[model samples]
Target: MKHSRILSRATAALALAGAAGTAAAHPGHAASLADGLTHPFLGLDHLLAMVAVGLWSARALPAQQRWQGPAVFVAALLAAALASLGGVSLPGVELSIAASVVLCGALVAGAREIPARAGLALVGATALFHGLAHGAEAPMGGFGGFAAFALGFTASTAALHLAGLWLAARLQRLPALAWSFIGAAVGTGGLALLAARL
Candidate 1:
């Protein structure tokens, strides 16, 4: 019933969810719809960044502008993911992914007012890295495998964003305060991932 309790519970839930992520996604296991659905949960970085985007959207953008950022993000993500099929791979994807998580946290924690266009651009830019990472490593099992994998991760990403939005709206205090804590946790997760690779 207390706001602090609610926030703590929410934060713990997110941390537990992050702990459940794996290092890599293998699309060979994603031929089924269920397999694809679980693909985005494969990495903590993906989980944090995706949800952070939604949290940022709810906090920074107005009601009319909220959908734009997320829409652009999804489009940019698809482009980068599809590009990986052509063998256009990015170096330092892990680091880039980690950085994106950090950036997402900063943006959510700050939650400054910004133009919708600028916000959309920011969301789109970071999403490109996340998408490319998944696309490059996606298993080449033909259209069905690729489709399932793509669909799974995409849906999962959307769900995470919604969760972030829900949390942003539900917190009793300033959204930024609750989000700042979440951001800190997500940033910490990114640091751990970066350290693991280095």
Candidate 2:
């Protein structure tokens, strides 16, 4: 694609991101499909990590199996969220989540350096942590409510992954410096988030 098209897409994506309603990490807010849809965009950690997963997959995986990364992540996220609803929980979840952003950003930076299987494993593990965090803040209603919220968030997360993939596709023509800058910004944001949590 031409630079103009790429820049247009980027601008549109940024506009949408800016326009979305923001949710706090672990807000403990009421759960609904709407809330769930907006949940992934609530925190930069979640947004950045989720998008980075897509970006890494685009850079690291063969075209034939590129979808696996997002598939595994979505599956793990849903499964983990369900597990949380079943009264299971993990400790140190917040810190792990923050670290996931850092790791994901790094993964995107050096996606080709890691083996594909290793990358998938890492992405899956990161999704698990994210799922646990999302589950922890599920709505207080019965399973029905949780189900709605889960559906909403799952859809949104998948969309974000697609957005990342699209962005990565555009990045293919850009110079290495562009990738490095993106990775650095993402990693630095994660670090800031991690420090705040500490």
**The best candidate in terms of lDDT:** 2
lDDT of 2 by residue, 68-135 (tens): 88999999999888888888898888888878878887887778788999999999999998898888
TM-score, every prediction: 0.84, 0.86
lDDT per residue, candidate 1, 27-102, as tens digits? 3334555765786676777778888888888888877777666677788888898887667887887777777777
In order, what lDDT does every prediction score? 0.73, 0.79
Q: Highest TM-score: which candidate?
A: 2
Q: Candidate 2: what lDDT?
A: 0.79
In model 1, the clashing pairs are 36-152
Supply the global lDDT for candidate 1. Answer: 0.73
Clashes of each: 1, 1
Relative to the true structure, candidate 2 reaches a TM of 0.86
